[model samples]
Target: MTGPEHLSGTDRVAEVIKDIDADIIINIQGDEPMIDPAIVNQLIDTFEDGYVEMATVASTVIDNFDYVNPNSVKVMIDGNGFASAFRRETKDFEIGGYYRHVGMYGYRKEILLQFTKLDQTKNEATFNLEQLRAWTMEFQ
Candidate 1:
């Protein structure tokens, strides 16, 4: 077998999934070593329609008034459960009811490839979010 080539995390994942025939691909963060298996199952189970091109896990944000912390990424989901935006501050909703994005993602194989080809956006560079590059390209 060939040795692992040096690539960015997104590139590595995209390459691995390029030939997958699965209906859904789960993208979990490598840093989250202790992530619950139940959460993984939950994300997989959410693909009821088979049309969910992308999805992510989130939990109720319980942090008190400290929305400025860059470590916490706030998210707003539409009524259809699609993510509208992500940011460090509580932009659209009240801080108490915000949901913190869990960093795990689910996508179709085709979407994953498309994501890998997109260039990083200005906002993404500003926030240092690689995922934002994919998001900005409307891949998910």
Candidate 2:
């Protein structure tokens, strides 16, 4: 199940499981060698509500440098706990609620496939944040 080189981690998982039957799919970035198991549990717990189709985690940015670094993606979560936006620039920190985007996600199988089928959105291409594509789809 090979995907395009430009496909993001979430997109790749969708492609990989196109043939497999599954209720849920979890995507943990390969770069995160020390991902905590508890985070996975938390993601699973989010699904217990039964209405969640997609989810991810975020933590407060402890280092100012990391917060400002364009390499460390920042996330803006809505009051409902769904991600509202993602950005790599620091200029918007003044808007306040900024958190380091954890490079992990859990998706309902159908939602994952739908995510991959959606076209890249303007913000997504601008920030190189694939999750933004799902954001545009109103998955939040």
How does each model score on TM-score? 0.78, 0.90
**Model 1 C-alpha lDDT per residue in residues 6-33, reported as the tens digit of each score:** 2346667778777767868898877667
lDDT string, candidate 2, 1-140, tens digits = 57566457777787788899789888998767788899899987888888899998888753687667888888887797777678887665344678888888999999888888888888887888888888788884
Residue 129 deviation, candidate 2, in Å?
Answer: 0.1
For candidate 2, give the lDDT of residue 3.
51
lDDT of each: 0.72, 0.81
Local lDDT at 20 for model 2: 95
Badly placed stretches (over 4 Å) of model 2 are 92-96
What TM-score quantifies how close candidate 2 is to the native fold?
A: 0.90
Model 1 lowest lDDT segment of ten? 1-10
Give each model's clash number: 0, 0
Residue-pair clashes, model 1: 0
The alpha-carbon lDDT assigned to residue 93 of candidate 2 equals 33
